[model samples]
Target: MTPAARLSAAIEILADLSARRRPAADALKDWGLSHRFAGSGDRAAIAGILYDTLRRRASAAHVMGSEEPRALVLGMLALMRGLSVDAIAALADGGRFAPAPLSEAERARLADSSLEGAAPFVRGDYPQWLHASLRHVFGDSVVEEGAALAARAPLDLRINTLKGEPEAVKAELSHLHPEPCRFSPLALRIKLDSEGKAPPVSAEPAFLRGEVEVQDEGSQLAAILARPVPGGQVLDLCAGAGGKTLEFAALMDNKGQIYAHDSDIRRLKPMHERLARAGVRNVQVRSPRGAEDVLHDLEGKMDLVLVDAPCTGTGTWRRNPDAKWRVRPGALAQRTAEQAKILEQAAHYVRPGGRLAYVTCSLLDEENGAQVRALLNKREDFSPVSPTENVLALGASGPALAEAALTSREGLLMSPRRTGTDGFFVSVMKRAG
Candidate 1:
C-alpha cells in the first residue's frame, strides 16, 4: 500500500474507534479482518499511524482546528512525523485510494499551526479532564511530563537469571542491538523502529528459552525495591499474570517459597506456563475457589507481601495512549477504593518486621502517596521505609535512581520525564514486630 492509502486506512480506523469508544487494538483488528488483502506491512503501518494519532490526539486536534479523522491524520503527519505542508498535500492529492485533497484551510493550518497559546492539555496531548490531577502531581512541569508520556516507549526485557546469565542472553539477542537499562542491572532496552513497532522478541531463541521476559524498567525497579530475601516466605497478593511473581522467583534463585494468588483466577492461568518456561520451581499458585479463602493458610506469615494494585495506568500512556483518553473520573474513584482495600488485605500477610511493597502504574497522588498515607493512618503497626533505604536494594544504580525519583513523604514516584521509565510509585512499609 502507498503511504497515502495507509493514512486513509488509519483515518477510517480512528473514526470507528471514536464512534464505538472502544480500544484501538480492537478497532485495528476488525479493520484487518475485513481488509484481508492488506499485507502485514500495511496493517502494521496503519496501526502505527493510528497509535501515533491517538498519542498526540489533543495537540493534533488543536493544531488542525478540527477533530475529524482526516484532520488528525494530517496534523499528526506534520507534528509527529515532521512532514511539511507540501509533503502532506502531496499524499492527500485526491488520487485513487488516497485521502481527499486538503482544503485551503487545512493547508493554511498545517503551514502555520503552533501550540504556543494552546491549553495545557492541548500542549501535553492528554485529556483536559486530567489537567488538574496532573497539575497537582507535576506542578509547573506537567506539560513536560505529559509530553514525555505521549512519546513512544522502548521495549524492556528482564533477564531470567534462573535460566540464563545476563551477559550470555544479551550476546544471544545481540542482533536486536539491545542496550542495558540505566536503573535495573538485569534489564536490557530495545528501541522500537522508526515507525514505532517493536521487534518480535518472542521469536528469539533466548526469549523462547525464558532467558528474558518483556517488562517495563519501572516494574523491574519496583520488584527490586521489594527486596525479597533468598529462602524467605513471600506472597504476591495481586499477582496478575505473575510478572513480578516470576521476577521474585528468579531473584530468590528458586530458593524461597513464593505463593502467588489473585482475586480472579482467570488472570493466573498464564502464570503456570510462564513459571514453567522460566524454570521457576519455587512458586505455588493459589487459585481462588468460590471465595473459600485461598490465601487463608498463609496470613500473617509472609516475609514480604507485594500488592501490585490496579490503577488508571496513567504512567503507561506511552504504550496505551488510548487508555488515557478512555479513563474517567468515576473509574479513578473505583480504582482508589480498590487499591485501599487490596493494600489492607495485603498487610495481613506481612509477618512482624517483614515488609509490604505497594506498587501502581499510576502518577496520581490519590492512588500513590495518598494511598500510602491512608494505609499508615489505618495500620499503626506499619511504618514507611524511607526513600533512601528503598534505593539500597539497587546497589550502584541506587544513587542515580534516587536522584531521578520524585520523593514523597511516603514513597518515591518515577515517571518518563524524571526517570526515563513508566510512571510507577513504590512505597515499602514494615510491619511492627
Candidate 2:
C-alpha cells in the first residue's frame, strides 16, 4: 500500500479509538484483521503512523486547532515527521484510497501552525488533566520532561551474566549493532529502525539461548538498586512475569533463595518459562492458592524485599503513549491505594536489618516520594538509604548515575530527560535490626 493509503488507515483507527475510548493497539489489530490484503509492511507502517499520531495527539490538536482524526494525521506529519505543506499535500491528494485533498484551512494551518503560546500539556503532547501532577514533579521544566517522554524509546536488553559475559553476548548479537547503555553495565541499547520498528531480537540466537533479556535501562537500574547480596534471602513480592526476579537471580549468581510471588496467579504464568530459559535456579515460584497466604511461612525472613509496585505508568509513555491519554484521575487514586497496601504487605517479609526497595514506572510525586515518605512515617523501624549509598551497587557507573538522577530525601527519580531512560522512581529503606 502507498503511504497515503497507510495514513488513511491510521486516521480510521484513530477515530475508532476515540469513539470507543479503547486502546489503539486493539483498534489497529481489528483493522488489520478486516483488511487482510494489506501486507506485513503495510500493517507495520499503518501501526507506526497510528502510534506517532497518538504520541503527538495533544500537540497536533493544538497546532491544527482541531481534534479530528484527519487533522491529527496532518498535524503529526508536519510536527513529528517535519513534512512540508507540499509533502503532506502529496499524501492527501484524493487519488483513490488516499485521504481527501487537504482543505485550504488545513494547508494554511500546516504552513503557519506553531506551539508558541500553547499550554504545557499541549506543548508536551500529554493529557491536559495530568498537567498539575507533572508540573508538581518537574516544576517549570515539565514541558521539556513531558516532551522527552513523548519521544520514542530505544529497545534495551540486559545480558544475563550467569549465561555469558557482556562482550561474549555482544559479539553473538553483533548484527543488530547493540551499544552499551550509559548507566547500567549489564544493559545494551538497540535503536529502532527508521520506521520506528524494533529489530526481531527475539529471533536472535543469543536471545533464544537466554544470553540477553529485553528490559529497559531504568528497570535494570531499579533491580540493581535492590543491592541483593549473593546467598542472601530475597522476596519479590509483586513479581509480575518475574522481570526483576530474573535479574535478581543473575545478580546473586543463582546462589541465594529468591521467592517470587504475585497476588494474581495469571500474571505469574510466563515466569516459569522465563526462569527455565534464563537458567535461573534460585527463584521459587509461589502461586497464590485462593485466599490462603502464599508467602505466609516466609514472612519476616527476607534479607531484601522488592516491591515493584504498580502505578500510572507515566514514565513508560515513550513505549506506550496511548496509556498516557487513557489514564484517569480515578485510576491514579486506585493505583496509589494499591501501592500503599502492597508496601505494607511487602514490609512484613523484610527481616530486621534487611532492606525494602520501592519501585514505580510513574513520574508522579504522589506515587513515588510521597508514598515512601508515608511508609517511613508508618514504620518507625524503616529509614531511607541515601541515594549516594544506593549507587554503590553500580560501581564505576555509580557516580555518573548519581549525577544523572534526580535525588530526593526519600529516593531517586530517573526520567527520559534526566537519565535517558524510562521514568522510574526507586527508594530503598532499611529496617532497624
Candidate 3:
C-alpha cells in the first residue's frame, strides 16, 4: 500500500477508536482482519501512523486548529515526521485509495501554526484532566516530562542471568544492535524501525534458550532495586506472567523461594510455561481459589514482599499512547484504591525487619506517594527506606543508575526525561523488627 493509503487507513482506525471508545489495538486488529489485502508492512505502517497521531494528539490538534482525525494525521506529519506542506499535500492528493486533499482551512492551520502558545496540557499532548496529577509529581518539569513520555519508546530486554551472561546474550542478539541500558546492568535496548516493529525476539534462539526477556528498562530497575537476598524468602505479590518473579529468581541466584501470585488467576496461568522456559525452578505459582488462598503460612515469614501493584499505566504512555487519552477521572480513584488495598494486604506477609517494596508503572502521585503515605500513617511499624542504599550497594551499575533516576519522597520516580526510562514509582518500606 502507498504511504498515503496507509495514512488513510490510520485515520479510519482512529475514528473507530474514538467513536466506539475502544482500545487502539482492538480497532487496529479489526481493520486488519477485514482488510486482508493489506500486507504486514502496510498494517505496521498504518498502526505506526495511528499510534504516532495518538502520541501527539492534543498538540497536533492545536497545530492544525482542529481535532478531527485527518487534521491530526496531517499535523503529526508536519510537526513530528518533519514533512513539509507540499509533501503531505502530495499524499493527500485525491489519488485512488488515497486520503482526501487537505482542505483550505487545514492548509492554513498547518501553514504558520506553533504549539508554543497552546495550553500546557495541549502542548504536552496529555489529557487536560491529568495536568494537576502530573504537576504534583513533575512540578516545573511536567511539560518536559510529558513531551518525553509522548515520544516513542525503544524495546528493552532483560538478560536472564540464570540462563546466560548479558555479554553472551548480547553477542547472540547482536544483529538487532542491542545496547546496554544506562540504568540496568542486565538490560539491553533495541531501537525499532520506522514501522515500529521489534525483531521477533520470541522466535530467536537466545529467547528460546531463556537468555533474554522483553522487559522495560524501568521495570528492570524496579526488580533490581528489590535486591532480594539469596537464600531468603521473597514473594512477588502481584506477579502477572512472572516478569519480576523471574528477575527475583536470578537476583536470588535461584536459591531462595519465590512465590508468584496474582489476584486474577488467569494472568498467573502463563507464568508456569514462562518459568519453565527460563529454566527457573525456585519460583512457585499460587493459584488462589478464593479471596483467602494459600498464603496464610507465609504471613510474618517473608523476607521481602514486592507489590507490582495495579495502576493507570500513565508511565508507559510512550508505548501505548491511546491509554493516556482513555484514562478517565474515575480510574484514578479506582486504581489508587486498588493499589492501597494490595499494598496493605501484601504488607502483612513481610517479616519484621524485612522490606515491602511498592511499585507502579504510573506517574500519578495519588497512586504513588499518597498511597505510600497513607500506608505509613496506618502502619506505624513500617518506615520508608532510602533508595540511595540500593544504588550504593550496586557493584558496577551504581554510579550510572544513581545518576539516571530521580529521588522522589515516595521513593525513586523514574521518568523518561529524567531517567531515559518509562515512568515508574518505586517505594521500599521496611517493617520494624
Relative to the true structure, how large is the alpha-carbon lDDT of every model?
0.94, 0.93, 0.88
Worst 10 residues of 2 by lDDT: 192-201
TM-score of 1: 0.99
lDDT tens readout by residue for model 1, 1-433:
9999998999999999889999999999999999999999999999999999999999999999999999898999988899999999999999989999999999999998689989999999888988999999999999999899999999999999999987899999899999999999999999999999899999998989999999999999999999998999999999999999999998899997999999988999999999999999999999999959888889889999999999999999999989998999999999999999999999888889999999999999999999999999999999999988889899999989989999877999999999999999999999999
Model 1 CA deviation exceeding 4 Å by range: none
Tens-digit lDDT track for model 3 on 1-433?
9988998899899889879998999999999999999998898889889999999999998898778898888999987787888899999998988999888888887787688778889878899999998888778878988899888999999999889987878898989999888868788999988667777789999999899899998998898888799999999999988899998898888897998888899899889988988889899888788866689889999999999999999999999999999999998899888998898899899999999999999988888889999999999999988877666546677766666677755588888998889999889899999
Ranked by lDDT, top first: 1, 2, 3
Native-to-model Cα distance after best TM-score fit, residue 324 in candidate 3, in Å: 0.4
Q: 308 in model 1: Cα distance from truth in Å?
A: 0.2
Model 1: how large is the Cα RMSD against the reference?
0.8
Per lDDT, the best of the predicted structures is 1
TM-score of 3: 0.97
| Model 3: lDDT to the true structure | 0.88
Better of 2 and 3 by TM-score: 2
CA lDDT for candidate 2? 0.93
